[model samples]
Target: MREFPQISYAFAYGSGVFPQTDGSASRPAMSPHPNPPEAILKWQKGGGKMIDFIFATKFTQHFHSLNLNRHRDHYSFLGSFGSSIISHVQDDWGAGAYFNPYITVNGTLIKYGVVNFKTLLRDLSDWDTLYLAGRLHKPVKILTEDPNIRVANQRNLLAAVRCSLLLLPPTFTERQLYTTIASLSYQGDPRMSLGSENPNKVTNIITHQIRNFRMLYHDLIMSLPNVDYGEARALQQGWMEDLKLDRPMAQDMDPAFRGNMVRRLPKSFRQKLYFLYQRKFGISGREFEGMLEASADEDAKGGLKKPVGGPFDRRVAAETDLREMVLKCVNQTVKWPSATQSLKSALTAGPSRTLRYLKEKREKGRENALCDGTIVALLGDEGNESMDSSENTTEDG
Candidate 1:
């Protein structure tokens, strides 16, 4: 859209994408972080920090080559070597994204990660790394999408709803639901352990960017078979739902729910979980697959045909097993590989900078990872509300 290369999908995220807080039509209000520090508020006015983006391109190597030809100076000495090395490391070792940090594109400091369009879809549907999945769970601006790709991604949004409802308690607030959804990809993430960001990071994202969270998930929330919004519109203060979790009805429905979630996972991931499900509870992959296909057939008959229909069924033993396996699979697959990518990252970062980069993560993690204050406040009371953009969103969003 901005004369960028052939991108199938792209988004601008973080404070950089946020509009100025002038509350005018052209400039939207800031996200609701009740008591943000002064620096954050200042940054909302328009910060000079590196803007972040996730780019799903037509071809990783071609894009990289084009980018290299145009902005040769953006990369470090090694980036000039070839695009092949970077593409291999991106797909084979690390999580799918191949990030080039601290590149100045036309005087604006930009950081972007490139991934194959196919890989992006898989991660969204299957929670492959939950790297992009996790990021997508929060608010982001969608720049472009192919028609079929946009339709396929609806399942990803549905999966997020189902997963969130499964883990949520019977009675919870809107913020609570989003917070749980936010925490899904972080369950076994090594970054959380290292204190790379705030333990309150997910909650903060929900509270601050409450409008985006609401706009994205509202349709999914309403689409649930067993919840009612009563009087509240999609995005409003004091919104709640009535969830009826009758245990017997829930148990009958568990198989369908389990099947849906398990089947949506990546093949290798699903296979591993399938074996474990059989070992623990004696349910074969075919049985699970059967339920998923049957359930899908229901969407046409006013959505997901079968029912013990509660917003979702109760969490069952198999669901718990699948959740554990997904965490283990994603964490193991991405953790060390990301570290390896970090090592290669030093190619772009000189000796002093590389050391500073490593040190900053470790030191900052140590400082913020264990903060006790943010923990207690999460469940206590509602904080003050902040501004949010109220424009209606479309699939293109």
Candidate 2:
């Protein structure tokens, strides 16, 4: 094992304390202030310690918008001075000792090492200039001027530092760390202070932090053991599956209708449909259904019997309202003397399209029947004739 540094500092600030219990009164109760720099220094001198420098709460029992793990905790980083010194600078600037830092730990990286923060800051300053274009929020100078402000600012910084430590890697340079923390830190309301009003500056700061975080976390992930990767992947997959089920399909049609249309379809047909949709409309399941429904409706109203002409067009019609139209044609053919040949011809044209056309015809027939009872009576007559023929044949036999 590599020789780890003996003296290491970690920051804790904001609502950085644990709730006071009867048994742990002297053990350091939770405080509204961020973690104190002195406390962080002491913890570093003592040994490995897990401290909260930032304020976090369990707001909900489940994750809402994103498919984040519900059981996993969510945190909010607050910038405060005492906590900032501990978490960010690793020591009070006033302190005489030169605190050379090495590592940071937050959510992912447990124990990792890095160069110093100053060098990282220099590199990140350049990065900020290029990408941020002076939009990034600079640290407030007023906090440094007043003793009271310094303490308060330090506490907030500590909270931000605490979050960074938990989430960042040890090898991250100061610039990387600073950028990340600054991004995570909340810029005060502009109305409250003139300095806070720059939206572009605030956005730049947040963007830098986010970018730094992505870099650091990605490194941390790569450093983890293969087993951890497998576990994370499985967890992510499970979450995605849950989302897929919970989230409604875009189309408004009943689940039964969708199932009836495609559930038992052959693999070849399914693949063909999937590709055809992806190529033509660049859409998926429910969207494709909606498009088909709309297209069929338009075709019906426009009186365009073959709006989408081709094998696929026929298939589309068969799968939608057009099925009724094709069915009506089949019924009409069946009423004729050469029913068998006509039915064969219709089927040969394409069973799917034939089905859709029949479906459309049925709808139209219903509408016509509603307008003129004569059409209904004629349909009834056809039914009666078929029944009478069957009865006559049965009696003669």
Maximum-TM-score candidate? 1
Candidate 2 C-alpha lDDT tens digits along 50-94: 222211111211111121222112211111222223233211121
Q: Which ten residues in a row have the lowest lDDT in candidate 2?
A: 370-379
TM-score of each: 0.68, 0.15
Q: Point out where model 2 deviates above 4 Å.
A: 1-138, 143-146, 186-397
Provide the lDDT at 119 for model 1: 83
Q: How well is each residue in 312-344 modelled by candidate 1, as lDDT tens digits?
A: 222332354545655555455456545565665
In angstroms, the error of model 1 at 39 is 17
Instruction: Give the C-alpha lDDT of model 1.
Output: 0.54
Please give the lDDT score at residue 192 for candidate 1. Answer: 72
Residue 291 alpha-carbon offset, candidate 1, angstroms: 9.3
